[model samples]
Target: MSESALQSVIHTGDGRTLTRSEFLSLINTYNWFLKDQAQLHLTYSQQDRDGEVTVEGFLNISWGVTMPIRLQIQDDKQTPPSPLITPEISIPVSPLESKRGMTRWGEYSDLHQIDENAETPDIIISNVPPAPIPYETTTLRPMRHKNTEQEAESNLVRCQSDASLVKMRRKAKTAAQREEERQHRFSINGHFYNYKTSIFTPTHGASTKVRITSRMSTHQVIEQLLHKFKIENDPEEFALYCVHQSGEKRKLCNRDQPLWERILQGPSEDIMKVFLMDREEEEVSNDVAQYLNLELPILEQVLLKLREEESKEIQRVISKYHHQHRLLSNVLNCKVSPHIETSV
Candidate 1:
């Protein structure tokens, strides 16, 4: 397989590169053999590159009854658009043969085939018992009675049980055990649905992270969100809403219903988001523009009143300045006041 200089690099759909350890962990988790894995193996060789690679190979893993697999790699002058190409693997060239064959009776599977000819007579045996047929026991010798002082024993080649082993009935699980099983889905246990969730708050104009389960109800989700945001108000005062990409909003009203199920019934998360806001404030905030318009007349009246008061104050200030201006103009014209004639 031809590898580029950056063949070791692992790229994600989100345009992030993972470390080698992380990449190998993911590849192991996926059960797909990486090209690097082949290169790292002591038995790996360029000559063996003609074969298809299976995750089970050399690792002694087997999925089902199928032929052996050899790892193969392909090269390109330009880099592939996919990150998986580096592993350099392809499907099996030959079709797997794990299907049912022609029908046959399994009970007499080891018996020879019966003759199907006109010369052969069809014998019908009724209530008359047939002669006893002897068959060898699957043992070197027959076992003696165990009651003797030194009992002679003959162990069978294959241990045979007289009857099928009685299966033990499983104990019923308690309510707490069932609850624990529902809540925890560790990666190793395999149903990995743990999502890194962010709870957005329209009221606070911010967001906070809170771990919640898909089985949680709308009321429970709202309560958790309120606690995460440190909101002192009652949880009932707040409501959880899903906002669509087209600016459509849907409120989750059923307090007992599963919150995640309701969200999935609508649009996908990428096309919508969960937001927390006050129930009453959400309705009022929608009509805030109209409410402001209603207050415009009162605001205009207050402005007019203020303007009338400002005009009166301006008239008083202008009268005071006008007397000072007249006196200054007479002094500039060199006209003496008649009251100061005697002093001159």
Candidate 2:
């Protein structure tokens, strides 16, 4: 922690302060390493989470918002196994530590019961270097070990790396890759009528949308919906029933298109529903209630999303055509330039 960082900052009620980046660096190193050591998460106020990252992947600080940094230990290595931390907290294994090597002090070390040849990674907290003391005291100060020196170097390397946006090695996107990304990530105006024979929740509400792609088959859509609802039931046991506005119901096969293109060609008012009925059931019961009022609000939102999707698609097409035209003009210019040179 640099004291210079405290010049423009607010403090908690108990009078503690550290930058967001500094706090993350401290906890994610040594005894509190979530990814490499303890395998835990760092969460903050209102159930917001931090450190959802991999060893190679990057995580950055939220400079706009900061949270308090008082460490709280919920579990500890104990005999009886209570929820609180024991009086003596066990030192977590550091990544740089080795199982080999011996202590410089040898027999005089407090841990004389153990073999003197083996090295211990932990250090006495009291032996930490003094901060501008008037003079040295009798209390022995620990000198830098090989492991400690290596740890400092490793930290220096990590600190040199960018702690804001992540940088990655990637190639240029192909047309197919761009299309796939747009399908999966970009939200659009889409409506699915779900006729349900079984209730998912007691409070009746319209969860009007599911994440889907145009190329997804009926089976994939069913699997996605089941996973979204946290249903453990096998996907094979269920089937989708497509109900036409004219009340014509048809069960779609596994390989069939989940969103039937033909059905989508119908007028806006001629809305159809896809029922997630059990395969064992003969047919959907007429009593499965329909609440058009609740659905109308959702349908309106879908229309708005659809307009945004169309606008985006139009822009993409226009850009693609412009790029093609530029290429074609370049080719023509190259051919014409050679012909003029021959004539000259």
Candidate 3:
């Protein structure tokens, strides 16, 4: 193999360079051996013009496989080049005996040939009963004794029964607590309103009377309003604000705080007016458009009602005008035709 061809194969695929020690270690670890008959031939006369020296050798591996290897070493003064090892012959080692002759069974039949003419003897025998066969039964012992197993099963059953009883008791207690909470009413004057659906009217015309518990937070009430009004915008864009009877507005900052805390801050007679407000101007505009889109059906119904009312009013006025015109025409006809009738 030429030096150029070996260099091409060495850097062809992963571009990996192996040193002399690493190359020898790989071959030795893989059980590859060099043949005693193979010899490494070196020609000192072919050294490069520079201080570089090239050594050529044949590496004999197992199964009579042989590969040509080349090493380029720099002079002691010059920096060494990256060492690379490349095999000239890439063909894998093949077995020595690839094919073997197979023998047929019939070819050896003559060695075990039977004497057919020597077996002509005749014999007669009376009928005999067959001997009875006996079977031995083997018993298997349980890993745990029967009593112990019964006791374990009973204990498991008792534990399961106790667990079920405890669960039932807990459920009953929770049910009783829930009933008590349902009966208990936290007295607070508050109204729930959504800004997205309400449009120009923030409170939706009039505030609603709501029954909320102390457990309910201002955040939860706002969430319920959003859900009730079917507001499609993000909940974070809206917040709860309290409007006092004194015409002062205060935004509810702590949403996680309980509703009772908010109720206690305001005047006693004045109802706590809580309404949803948009956090951002962009969100407000977008939500207003969305709300208008969602209220399209209701808007159409309202338009239909207004048109019906206008039509009814117009009909009533027309009927009144017709009644007055008929009276005027009757009076004119009676006065204008009286002379003619009298003359006739």
lDDT (tens digit, per residue) of candidate 2 on 95-163: 665565432433322222343333345534676776884454556875533588777777653453221
> What TM-scores do the predictions have?
0.23, 0.25, 0.21
**Worst 10-residue lDDT window, candidate 3:** 60-69
Query: Which residue pairs collide in model 1, if any?
Result: 51-70, 52-70, 52-71, 53-70, 53-71
**Candidate with more favorable, higher lDDT: 1 or 2:** 2
lDDT of 3 by residue, 35-54 (tens): 33233221211224642223
Prediction 2 TM-score vs. true: 0.25
Q: Comparing 1 and 3 by TM-score, which wins?
A: 1
Candidate 3: segments with Cα more than 4 A from true spot: 1-205, 209-211, 254-258, 265-272, 280-344
Candidates by TM-score, descending order: 2, 1, 3
Best by lDDT: 2
Query: What do the candidate models score in CA lDDT, each in turn?
Result: 0.41, 0.44, 0.41
Provide backbone clash counts, one per model. 5, 2, 0
